[model samples]
Target: MRTHNTIPAFGLGTFRLKDQVVIDSVKTGLELGYRAIDTAQIYGNEAEVGQAIAESGVARQDLFITTKIWTDNYAQDKLVPSLKDSLAKLRTDQVDLTLIHWPSPGNAVPVAQFMGALAEAKAQGLTKRIGVSNFNIALMKEAIAAVGAEAIATNQIELSPFLQNRKVVDFAKSQGIHITSYMTLAYGKALQDPVIGAIAKAHDATPAQVILAWAMQLGYAVIPSSTKRENLASNLLAQQLQLSDADMAQIAALERNGRLVNPDGLAPAWD
Candidate 1:
């Protein structure tokens, strides 16, 4: 599997996973050799994820679990307690990584305050690392300046074939900031695109596989979600699928700045 700074590049996204679905998905993913699981306070399924992990028979040390703090929990006082709640729900003492879900524009807490809280959480063993999600270049710079370079591990964002995000990806690479690409399949839209279909056919793979391979080739960590066993299995196999330079160029040409998830009302301009 591809890895970025020691973290696995391929993970199972649990954005909308819940109850038995989340539990079964976690169990299936773990059994399928997925060491990374992504959850969030907003996902409302940490409890199920925890239950699945507990039942999966996988050692906690061998798994990399990630959770995120929602916008309402940004206050310094609220941060740690919120994390504790997440811990309880996840059934773990410490997660591998914790992220700020979104930088709420008007309610945006000072990077120093919350980042300091995150650092404190690390020191207290609440999480092994801390990072942010939906953060653009300016916010990432501010966060690094506030939290110190070594403390910021990653910046998760919406990235896929249609929204390549080359500028931010390039900037993150320069700063040694690894990126986790959520919505890497464009919420399943890319699976039906004619161009992607042709590329997948050329490689004897599915369109989802082709798009995911492209993301992996560009060195972005990917988290693609699916409820079906076949989809999950196919997605994991994306690691072994290779796209030629010409294929990559064609995929790159599909970028139209299309975004699948834009809770813009919850945050400022992503760019």
Candidate 2:
């Protein structure tokens, strides 16, 4: 079952993956049935992702490609052009979705300014959808004020079993903005939890599968990346893993505000 309408419930994420390593990951993922590929300018792997896609023999129309604009390009003058550069690198004329990589550092760029530029990028057909990432409740309000909630496709965040992010999740739900849960595995930390292990054992699934299923069951889109083919295939199989209500509650109790993606200057004051 897909989440967020057009967005796939499960996708391949490419963060901290670079060069041939990223290239191989994406190619293998596409072969393994991953249709959505997430990359960011900051990830420095868009071109590699594009290459893998171009070489994978999968038609462009069959794939859903997403890329994020880095903070340095938040300026109105730079947003669209930067996206165009990303498109060129991705070997596509338009991406399925594009996002603000992060909020303007210390409000260096106003919400309306960069968001308007992103909307214009959509208007010009540079991307089919536009959204934001790592935005807090206040920032989401500003984005909605700038482009209306209907225009923002999603708010991708560092969501995992250990960092449930209920406050941000609730706010996004109230406004009808979809949530995209990045790092749903908490960098593999949740896989080691005894509670998750018990649940996985009960279902005959991996801990990663349990966590990904939990997120998807909550109606959030997830993009979990892996360099190994076995892990990639297993993660995709997570779409079929169903957790019992008891299993859900057990995982819910594991939330202890564990966040692994916070960068000093680049991250915003989270919700």
Candidate 3:
């Protein structure tokens, strides 16, 4: 198993991608040396991601795969079984990490119930680590109470230059939970910002690279996705694009509480 105190700092995010497109993206990512892959049942492309992994011949030991359990399957009776289904679709016996996709709709399911099931799944070797996504400060506290902070590997959330989410980030950090940034580029919204664009020009990097670098520099693991091979290849180089403190502060100033992925029922009251 890929053992680490924190989630991988960078990975390939498979959100809103499916069928041949996701398959191709994963395949290209593997070919380009990406070992960590992130997917969720709600994304509907676990099977394709598995197909690419299996066909790529990458040894299971070398890959770190993460999948999220949808809120619909949060019940104790359904959690582990749904995870096993995800494993089957991903062509893997276990996932490196598993997260609760979102809090149960209207708190229909108690946090302790599903978290207990998730812990059971980890104990049973279905997932090496357990975490939660889209969780705000209050929800994070509840999750920690359910399983203890030690069991939570990361709190994956929507964080980017446009939506810094420092309050949530600070809380997770205080609880010793690593933060993973999904949609770190703000769905290409940050790419057009003059601040990010200028930083990119200053460093001879793409706007996407500037934003990804900015997030990583702040210690949040980032999973930025792309369908094109060139974008995928170039984006990985963000790891090497270090930003100065001034550059980072400039990006921080761009935060306007601009959250883009909050679904009406799916998102909780963010901090």
What is the per-residue lDDT of model 2 for residues 26-133, given as tens digits with 9 covering 90 to 100? 999999989999999999888999999999999999999999999999998999999999999999999999999898988999999999999999999999888999
- Model 1: lDDT equals 0.87
Once model 3 is optimally superposed onto the true structure by TM-score, how far is the C-alpha of residue 213 displaced, in angstroms? 0.6
- Candidates' TM-scores? 0.95, 0.97, 0.98
Q: Model 2 segments beyond 4 Å from truth?
A: 1-5
> Model 1 segments beyond 4 Å from truth?
1-5
Query: Model 1 over residues 149-222: C-alpha lDDT tens digits?
Result: 56778889999888988888888888888889998888778888899999999999989889988988988888
Tens-place lDDT digits, model 3, residues 98-153 = 99999899999999999999999999999999999999999999999989998999
At residue 89, candidate 2 shows an lDDT of 94
lDDT of each: 0.87, 0.92, 0.92
Model 3 regions lying over 4 Å from their true place: 1-4
lDDT of 2 at 216: 98
